[model samples]
Target chain A: MHPRLTLALTLIEAVAILAYAISGFIEARKRRLDAVGTFLVGFATAFGGGTVRDVLLEHRPFYWVEHQTYVIVLFVASLFAPFVLRTLSRLFSERALLVADAIGLGLFSISGTSIALEAGMPAFTATLMGVATGVFGGLIRDVLCNVVPLILRDSRPYATCAFAGCWLYLLLDHFDVDSVYSLIIATAFILIARLVTFKLNVRLPH
Target chain B: MHPRLTLALTLIEAVAILAYAISGFIEARKRRLDAVGTFLVGFATAFGGGTVRDVLLEHRPFYWVEHQTYVIVLFVASLFAPFVLRTLSRLFSERALLVADAIGLGLFSISGTSIALEAGMPAFTATLMGVATGVFGGLIRDVLCNVVPLILRDSRPYATCAFAGCWLYLLLDHFDVDSVYSLIIATAFILIARLVTFKLNVRLPH
Candidate 1:
């Protein structure tokens, strides 16, 4: 891996984790779960998809297990979430949660697709895995919270955004596009698509 | 694996999957999910735990993916679930579902523990993985149906039953008990524990 590209990927992962954790925190608060429940949901939202992906691919040393420091950081942050959330309730609005989740979705889609490609999986399977790696975390989170999963019920283009972005990444890679360029374009596409869909209230038929 | 042991394990696997799928079908009917939804929930309940176990153990080709025949079998069965459930509803009462689930829980607990041991995981980790393999499918089923997971909420000996059985299996193995004998003893322990708990209406305080 190019040093510069590795650095970029790492940055995206960090940001995505933070974004997803915040969204999970907000959802946990809405349900009035205790500290343990809040932390569990947040952890699941941030890492469940990748964990599943690694498992399916037979990868060892799961991301969270490999980076124990990240788990420690998340734990410390979760401990203070309730107090921080109470103070910043206005700024951390429902829209904010959607935006954070969208950002995570975009970053994860690119990362997952790239990893699957590197693993030498077939294109269709790689794309499906990429979408699964992007959306399964949120799916797990919603299920843990005992709600109809948003991806299943909401007409908004959630998994669709990830699917589109992943396919774009795969297509660009096939066309001999530079890795960094493809990553940026794919990620931005998903983020923007999600935001626009939300703003315009665009929905698929129920 | 010994030929007899392997045969026994395969039979248990078949029975456990069927039992869990039936439980899942009942839950889907209770929620009035359509055919697609019914199949999705049933698949999750039947396969979710083993999927998690295989992933954590870095096993490849996921059990269902490897055995596409099982997927087809389950799909065909799920298609007829609503009709069969309607006719069998009175005979296959809620109590029957519990019993069936308990049987699955016991079988999965032993299978997971044995597999983990074969994979050379530490004893404690193997034990925990065993319990996870026993209970996670049902947990996924409950979550998808927008209910608090039974293992997490139900006061009865749910996960506890699996945990106890797994430990029993591990201890018997340590004592050089015959593999077949140990598996049967452990599985029976879990099945009996769960049935007795339900019969006595035993529950842990919330």
Candidate 2:
């Protein structure tokens, strides 16, 4: 991956982590869980996907080693969880969750695919890793909450967007396209596809 | 390992897989998810940890391969999920979930440790595999559900029991004890300890 692309991914990752952490905090506080619940959910919601990606790729010490930003983001998110949750009733909705998660899915798919290519994984494997990284965290968080996974559910386009964007990235890479161009194309595809599907109730075939 | 112990594990595993699959079905139904949702979560609830363990341990085909019984069990559980759930609900509660999960923890820890040893992994690495085998399934399920992981949380004893059992098994194996005795001792130790912890609401100190 190009240096500029790498930098772009780092920034997007930072934002995605922060966004998901906030979502987790809001969820925990709504349950009236104590501090531990907030932090635990926040941590999982933030790092779960990336951690799974890293471990599967056999990356040592994990991604948390390079950046403490995710941890800090979760901490900061947890601190304001109570206050934010109060206003969440106005600002948060199913539509909002879809948007935030879609943004996250785009960032994670790009980053995971980029890392897999850097690690010399095959294009198909890279795409699979990208989709896994983008979606598995929320899946884990949902399962623990005793809810149906968003990705596995019939009514959601979560994994479908990730899968589409991942394939786009890999196909672009195979053509030796510029990293930034590939990323922009893939991210836009994911975000637009996700938003449209959510709004229209489009779902994958059974 | 003795045939008796193997038989015992197989029986427990069959029940556990069916039980977990049923839980997944209940959640999927609550969301009004389609057949895909029911099957996917059922698989995750049953095979998530084992898949993670096999992938991590570099074992191919996975445990669900030889014993297709697990698949049959998951299918049956899904088909009759509504009836099974009504019956299960009368018996299932927070306490029941914990107990069933604890049984899975012990069985997974013991069997995973034994497999690691058979593969000639180092003792510590074997222990790690044991823990991974025991926790990864629930971790996957929780991620799918988009909630905080119980293993990661301070909620009761989970991974620690596996760790202790791993070490105990290692010690017995190192002393050249019969593998049968070692497995029995380790599994019993973990199951009893986990049950006690759940009963007493014992938890790890932060």
In order, candidate lDDTs are 0.81, 0.74
Per-candidate TM-scores read 0.59, 0.58
Question: What does chain B score (TM) in every candidate?
Answer: 0.89, 0.85
Query: Can you tell me which runs of candidate 1 are displaced by over 4 Å?
Result: A1-12, A65-72, A86-96, A146-148, A204-206, B1-43, B49-58, B67-139, B148-206
Error of 2 at A8 (Å): 5.4
**Which ranges of candidate 2 are over 4 A from the true structure?**
A1-11, A85-98, A120-125, B1-50, B54-115, B118-206
The DockQ-derived docking category for candidate 1 is incorrect
Q: In candidate 1, what are the lDDT values of residues B1-206, reduced to their tens digit?
A: 77987788787778778888888888877776655456667888998998889878876666676566666677677668767677667667777766777889998888889989999999999989999998899898888888878789778878888898999999999999988889889999999999998899898888
What tens-digit string does per-residue lDDT give for candidate 2 at B165-203? 889988998899998778778978898898887678887
DockQ of each: 0.16, 0.20
Best by TM-score: 1
Deviation from truth (RMSD, Å), model 1: 6.9
Count of backbone clashes for each model?
A: 0, 19
B47 in model 2: Cα distance from truth in Å?
Answer: 5.4
